[model samples]
Target chain A: MQPTETFFSGFAPHDLWFLGEAALRTLWLSLLAISIGSMIGVVFGWLLSVSRIGGGFVLSPLLDIFRSVPLIIQLVLFYNFAPIIGLRLDAFDAGLIVLIVYTSANVAYVARGGIEAVSQPMRRAARSLGMTYWQDMRYVVWPIGLRAVFPAWVGVALGVMKDSALVSVLGYVELLKASQILITRTQETILILAIAGAFYFALSYPISLYAAHLEDRWNQ
Target chain B: MDYNFHWRPVFKALPDLLQAALLTLEVAAISMILGVLIGLGLSLIRIHMKGPVMWLASIWVELARNTPALLQLFFFGFGLGAFGIHFSPYLIVLMGLTFNNAGYLAENFRGGFGAVPDTQIRAARSLGMTAFQTYTRIVIPQVLRIVYYPMTNQMVWAVLMSSLGMLVGFRELSGETQFFASRTFRIFEYFAVTAVIYYIIVKIILGASRLLAMRLFRY
Candidate 1:
């Protein structure tokens, strides 16, 4: 079908809704990945921070190299290569796992930084009050560290949201992939792609502003 | 685990992969050069321009920063064709990286500019420096020093992100790797080699940047 001269002519109501559904998938995948990623990251990051002084000194450079490779490369590597190594995963599962690792890597760094940002005196003060180690973390170190890393975490969220789009390479029906299907079907490539970009811009713009606000308040 | 490790396919593919690696670096270097020049202009406009012009520049920066680079590439490669403008994959990917890089570098540059106190610019102006003279002789030199590290990071980032060109059929390093992997049916071996190639590329870039930074910024 030849597209009309105008960019907007071909999108039916359901076509718009199709784009909406794709956006929902993007949000779902991003939210799911970030939630799981954060949980795993806390453990890894806590260990990294705790052991940085003497032990577990080895994991830092490993994580750095792991993350340095492009997300696309990692996604393709994990998705295509895992099954042959006795780790079988379908496209969606593969995408999810790799993205979790991707997001978790960033979160791990943030978590480590957050942990280190907690003051030594504060830890001692909590311990002097007869609080256990867990209590000290729950009360003092956790709150301060979490607060210090809030802005950085938001930045990671934005990064994860964008990175999730790369999972489309594995044939996941996320926003970018869905937009490709629609563009082909309707011959409205420009409109569909613009819509997809707008969806992402919508998600990220407000969060960025909020992150900026948090940074400003923190600086104050 | 029943997998057999085969290094032969990877070794056989080395020459093509290395050549493709060179292509990847070329694209990244060109995009970064373009990004820096355009980013400098964008930063200037964002900071100095007013009204709709400023708003437009800001929206460009924000959208590029926020969207996935993959989608951004598709927008150019496929989306422009709907408007009767078709670009080759190489051009599309280049535009994508350049646009995204410009947005990020613009913000970095803006921050660098903010770090320089107004007193310095005023001092230059009072010393008979024109606006252009003040910027060329004083402001930009200092801002360049402050922003050099971030610029290196962005350069490395461009190299990595250009891997997305594979999706658009641009035969950069990853694209070539994908091609070889599919043909050989040796997915693991092929990607593992590509991963190592990528690692080496990244290390070389980081090392080179550090050495360059040391030479350029001695106290």
Candidate 2:
């Protein structure tokens, strides 16, 4: 933490150990958000595919607003205003709520769009096969829609991973905030930020590659 | 504990918040324009560059798309100062956003270019159009049309991403809200009003883009 300290020379073994823990924390939070959010998205998306006014008119617009607003501002609001709303959430829970809501909005849109894109003629064919609405959805729409939605879900998962850094602003001590802590202690921004960026890239890139793999497989 | 609703603090901070919203718009607008140009250039490089050069372009896209924007902001804001080079918060954020926008838009523009039929380019070339003239007259216009929706999406993204400037202590709309909310202890009201402003700004952009789409794509 000296004035003339080098970012590399100032680095200790435990600075990395701290980063490891933060990476794990970031991973768990993003996984939780994506898993739960995608589940909620499937239900809402299915509903949207079926209903016009409620899904098209209301839910779609609501989700657009959610996507348009920045995640950090939403974090700040939910964290600070929890008390006013009679909600007693710790920082982790508050962060999770924001992550889930944000992820779900994006996923829901993807899911709905995917369902709608599953060709009208195929649905008519399914109907001619004596399939009930539920049976048709279970057999046809869900499979086709899910295939189209997977690539987008990958994007949402990566987006949630990056935006998870914002939860640090709410004092969650996640990866980015932990790096901020390290910067204060070591007085080296370059090394710390670079490591943080690399960690995020490591976390996100594999998921993307996997999505690409699945997309190719499905396309074939 | 029961909470009493207050609108006074929100009303008093209105002018500053509006000004800050404009600043946010300015940052987004400038970065988006710069981003589109850089993105176009980068896409050209991605398509035309060979071997290591193309790999380098792809790396930029991957890095920018994958990492957190906040990290890029911090790197520009604080990391460069480690080398005794300081950037103003505005400049740092602009740099960060430009980097990010170029990366995402490069990929987008590449796809746009792909969507343009090869036959058109060949047809233009056969008619004695120079390379530059072919691009300007035939290819780029179609690429712009193909990518227009993605461009608007990027605009909304830039506007939202500009809020990160607050973390570097740059006072855009969210930053101003953070400032006043803490001072007035009106976190809810300030953010609520600010949220409405963000919502309105996004709505306007969406509305305007819709109108433009209808008019321009009326084929």
Which candidate leads the pack in DockQ? Answer: 2
Q: Global CA lDDT of candidate 2, please? A: 0.89
Candidate 1 Cα outliers beyond 4 Å, as residue runs: A1-10, A53-56, A121-131
Q: In terms of docking quality, how is candidate 2 classified?
A: medium
TM-score of 2: 0.95
Q: Which pairs clash in the backbone of model 1?
A: none
Candidates in order: C-alpha RMSD to true structure: 3.0, 2.3
Q: How does residue A19 of candidate 1 score in lDDT?
A: 80
Tell me the chain A TM-score of model 1.
0.90
For residues B56-148, write the lDDT of model 2, one tens digit per residue.
888988999999998988888888988999988889989999989999999899989988889999999999999999999999878989899
Candidate 1: C-alpha RMSD after superposition: 3.0
Residues B25-140 of candidate 1 have per-residue lDDT tens digits of: 99999999999988888899988989998898898899889888888888888878777898888899899999999999999999999999999999999999999999998999
